[model samples]
Target: MSEAVLRLSGLEKSYNRGKPNEVRVLRGVELALVPGEIVALVAPSGAGKSTLLHMAGLLDVPDAGTVEIGGREMGGLGDRARTAVRRREVGFVYQFHHLLPEFTALENITLPQLADGATERAAQARARELLSRVGLEARADHRPAALSGGEQQRVAFCRALANGPRILLADEPTGNLDPATADRLFDVLMELVADEGLSALIATHNLELAARMSRVLRLDGGALHPQA
Candidate 1:
């Protein structure tokens, strides 16, 4: 079998480690995403879904256990190494678009590629290509405020994919949109992942949308359980 693109084993995380109000977010949480797989992570509010995504994307660290991307262990890597891996190998989308208010859609997408060492011309070209893929080529010059909610989220998706990362981790990516818009955006997200052959772990509260993914897993009581 092909190796897993992203894996988590025995992950444990707690806030306020030694305090009475401490909260344990993840307890021995584990997951594996193979190439081209789309996994839906279903969890209720305050269930640590965002925390899990952060750990997977290297935005945060687990108190115990390991995060492996493309078979390389991340727990012991230095800051620079972890940052480099995050830039080149992982992509993340949150509930909010979080686009820079000043930059145009195209610019927003181009910036990450530039940060990853691509030339200006290459970055712009890549940005244009991604916008076109999402059928937003004409809105490339529009700022986030100028676009509709759905459009802004679509642009955010393009931004996450700008670096062509192998793994995509999204936290309620379409949650802010209306149901109709959410459905449409989710379709685009799935298409984008498939076209890029990316392994994705998308956390969402919508069961109808979850049913469309390759597999579904539930996060409850700080652990992961495969959905039947």
Candidate 2:
């Protein structure tokens, strides 16, 4: 079997540590995602789904255990090194479309590539290509405010993939859309992931959507279990 593209081993995280009101968000969670696999993460609200995604994407540190991306241990990496690895290997989407209102769809998608050292022309070309793939080429010049919710989220998807990251960690990517829109957008998301050959861990409450992925895991009581 191919090596896992993203692995979380024995992860543990807590809030307000050592305090009377401390809350444990994760406990000994282990996960591994091989290339080109799309895994659905199902969890109740406030079940630490976001926290798990953060750890997987290197946005947060675990109190215990390690995150390995592309076989590199991330626990001991400095902030700069972690950031570099995250920029080059991880992509993230949230429950809401967080596109910058001031930037056009194309510009928003181009910004991350620029930050990663790509030239402006190259970033723009890549942005256009992704937009085209999602059928948003004509809306590239529009800002988030000018686009519908579904369109805005689609642009957000393109922006997330702009850097060609190996792993995509999404927290309720279509939670805000209506049923029909959510279903359609999810189809686009799966297509994009397949085209990019990425491994994805997407959190959602929609069972129908979860059933479409390659595997399903339930996040309950701060740990992961295979969905029966």
The lDDT for every candidate, in the order shown, is: 0.96, 0.96
Please give, for residues 143-213, the per-residue lDDT of candidate 1 as tens digits. 99999999999999999999999999999999999999999999999999999999999999999999999
Q: Which stretches of candidate 1 lie over 4 Å from their true place?
A: none
- Per candidate, the number of residue pairs that clash is 0, 0
lDDT of 1: 0.96
TM value for model 2? 0.99
